[model samples]
Target: MQTASGDTQSRLPDTIVDESALDELLSRPSPALQSFIKTVSSPLVILGIGGKMGPSLAALALRAAQAADHPLEVIGVSRFKGDGARPWLEKHGVKTISCDLLDAEAVTRLPEAKDVIYLAGLKFGTAQNPSATWALNTLAPARVCERYSRSRIVALSTGNVYARNEVSRGGSIETDPLTPLGEYANAAVARERIFEFHSRRNGTSVALLRLFYAVELRYGVLVDIARKVHAGEPISLATGSFTCIWQRDANEMILSALALAASPPAVFNLCRPEIFSIRQVATRFGELMDRPPRFMAVETGLDLLGNPKKVCDALGQPPVTLETMLRWIAHWVTTGGRNLGKPTHFEVRDGNY
Candidate 1:
């Protein structure tokens, strides 16, 4: 991949997006989703339906249920089903169960459903605590999938499983060989492999959505850059190109997978059609805020990224454009999104969960 000489400062072209565009993207379901909805014989159970992006996914599943004309008992599974999400799910009359999937008792209690969305996993910088990441992020799902291999499973994976950029031009693909650069991603790779192994042995249908960055109320990577620039701190960079998708549209793609998972062990790259360098993302924030970004350049490789191919084909389109989604985030930040709160990951130094 040839980059310009002043690559760090070479910003990608700008884009403008509107609310109508957002609505339109959310309206359609991916082919994979349609397949799951049309053919799966049971209700859909989505684990991690209570985490960062869970609320949006839960809402999408309910809407998909109504649109597909299928009887979907959409259940939200989380360790502590928070109240913030309850309002949205309750509005849709979505069901929820509070339990840690890691608990044998909890796994046993999960209601039988033909289509399952395994959304539960540890997210974020886990290089410091490899074991804990391996346990919750990798081991738990492996166990749960084994417990319910008969169900069609749409297990969540990460773009992190792919090799870091320099090798990936646009990004990674479904059959791309994996190189786990960090502990967090290694566990994630392990999680996906567990499903593959089980599916091979038990004939369970599975699809691994290799998710890249998905954004909603909170500041995603762009906002992270903005916050640093906003507060007048220097933004750090490691020459990397990444992809992001709006949560609303991204959720629709994942739910679509449950319906698409009728086949055994399918892997799809979940990301927007657009690819932008880390610096370009920062510049967008600067553009929206009408300020110049404060940034320092360096070379970086940990690109948990993708180019949306499988998702587009399966979900009927690519994830929302980077600029459109970033615009939404900029608006939220300007109006004060008010920190919706995030999960606490293990400290990098503490090799504990």
Candidate 2:
């Protein structure tokens, strides 16, 4: 793991890293991303840019092109319902397009671009509205693929598509059989299949990024644990261990995937190579917050983990390590940090989101 600047570590303040500051940090692209951006063209369109990962990712793409001395028009597409995500992205020089991906005509009318990053999908409200989840997860991908059939696409996928793997075996690889547990996981698998089907039929180049939890101070597994620990609540260990990457790392790798797109869509697991234990993560958060972490469950054999060796080999590992994220998140949570009100539901052992 890459060590972050010790100066930044030593000077950590006792306050929440505000939204703007965190966004700026996440938008800073790595050296690998800059080199990869040199190979791509302008007018890159990112669908579903309103999501947690999308805004920074869109910003990262724009920054990478600038750093590489390339002029690029980066467009972020979303419904623009609320959350100020659209405005924030636009402020970072990302062209904003308001369109609901579910509306087929709206999707068809979207501008043609040389590259596409599909980040649109449903996950959080799967249990109550399974139909909506299926529609967005599977149907939306099909529509996006059809609209940009010829363009090189890098679609965001979830690690939940794979069955829980034993901890000793490390994590699930790209080729592992997907035996996802609930409606949400199954729908995610369907999402991948839809993209694969279209990529095969239209001869479109595609890359499926199977990413686990991507963490920042705002949301993700690390935030969930940090929040719980800071509040002096007991953390659950039902899921045992999991994998995650910093938001900056995930954003850079997602942009780099444009170079890996293939006619027969290639799959790559996106997460830190290490499998992190929930108890240890919680305990670390406790230490940072001056509170002892309370545990509620035993470590199970099953865990939602992924093997990111392929992506690490291709795009290089993230500069921010898990320990770095823990330190950042701990400080953020202990000092009245704001959450995006989204939970990872990492406690779900039945695979239900």
Candidate 3:
């Protein structure tokens, strides 16, 4: 993926945080984002904004509003167990609010906004604590939707809502039947239903974005694989294929989806519009890192994949490409770039995440 400047390597430095590279990347405004900013009113509330992608998404909204010359308030809501995310978001002109969405009173007290982005959910560790996963995924959305029933909401969802598919068929489309495995995936389905029910009952505009995986320098499927390869660990090919999008690309898409929210709650799969071979991607990473790629499992034909044709047609191809992201990830990892220590369990097939 060639960067916006077409010089992929020279632009991205080793220190993403110290130099505010992530801020710059996330805040870069495009036509779609600028247009979305103009359509919505002030005070866009991003619920559950403490997750891996929440801060950047909130900052992106703030910057886009600024760039559009229609500056509006952007508030980030989260438990904020620590001060790290709050400080960064506050510094970026996003109002930070520490509110646990699980608490009904806390949600009721939340300042209402015209636009809301739902990024809160639990995925990993669902095997042990299934109740928490269900509660976070289902109950949280119910509270958010009930509180802001009239706001145009772009809720984040997971592609895991769809069962595994073969790489040959281009992956699952939005209209495909959802037969997701595991408690977490089922919980995700319930989350969408809650949002849909609210949309129907209250005429709240809703858009559910089912993302496969998002990759960046610090944390993502690519980063996880790169770290494993760097540690001389064997890459698993059990789930042979996957779909992913660059972090900024995914964030931008999420922002743009605000414009696509409908009364009946539209569904869009958020990912690169192509199926990627794990072996091929890992081998490419190995070649870039000058490390021999090690493989450990037989390629299983079934895997979680998504068809982003609808979104691609609506928003066009993401600015960054898979190849460009690989180059960036390779450079970042080789030069001792930081990882968020959050591993995406892309290898898990039994829905036991």
lDDT of each structure?
0.65, 0.85, 0.84
Tens digit of per-residue lDDT, candidate 2, span 1-353? 12223333354343436777787777776655676787777789999999888988888888878988988899999988988997788788999999988899989999989899999988877888899999998778988998999999999999999998799999999999998899999999999999899989999999999999999898998998988887788888888899998887788788888888998899999998999999988888878888998889788888879999888888776667777788888877777778889988889888667
Candidate 3 ranges beyond 4 A from true positions: 1-19
Q: After superposition, how far is residue 53 of candidate 1 from its true place, in Å?
A: 1.7
For model 1, state the Cα shift of residue 330 in Å.
1.9
* TM-score quality measure for candidate 1: 0.81
**Residue-level lDDT tens digits of model 1 in 1-353:** 11111221132223324433433334344433544555645567778777777766766566556677877677888876455666656666778777787787778878887778888888554656666667887667767776788888888888778766552467777777987566766788888888888888888898888887766545355666556556667765654566776666667667666656744588888777767676777787888877677777663654545877766765555434566656666765666655545522211222222
Q: Write the per-residue lDDT of candidate 3 for residues 1-353, one digit (tens) a residue.
A: 11122232245444354336755875666655766677767888999898888888877777777878886898899999984999988888889899988999999999979889999999888999999999998889999999999899999999999999887889999999888899999999999999999999999999999998988788899888887777789989998889999887888888888888998999999998878888988889899899878999989898899999888777777666778778777778888887788899889988998
RMSD list, candidates in order: 7.1, 2.8, 2.9
Give the residue spans of candidate 2 off by over 4 A.
Answer: 1-17
Question: Distance from true position, residue 159, model 2, in Å?
Answer: 0.5
Listed in order, each prediction's TM-score against the native is 0.81, 0.94, 0.94
Better of 1 and 2 by lDDT: 2
Error of 3 at 119 (Å): 0.8
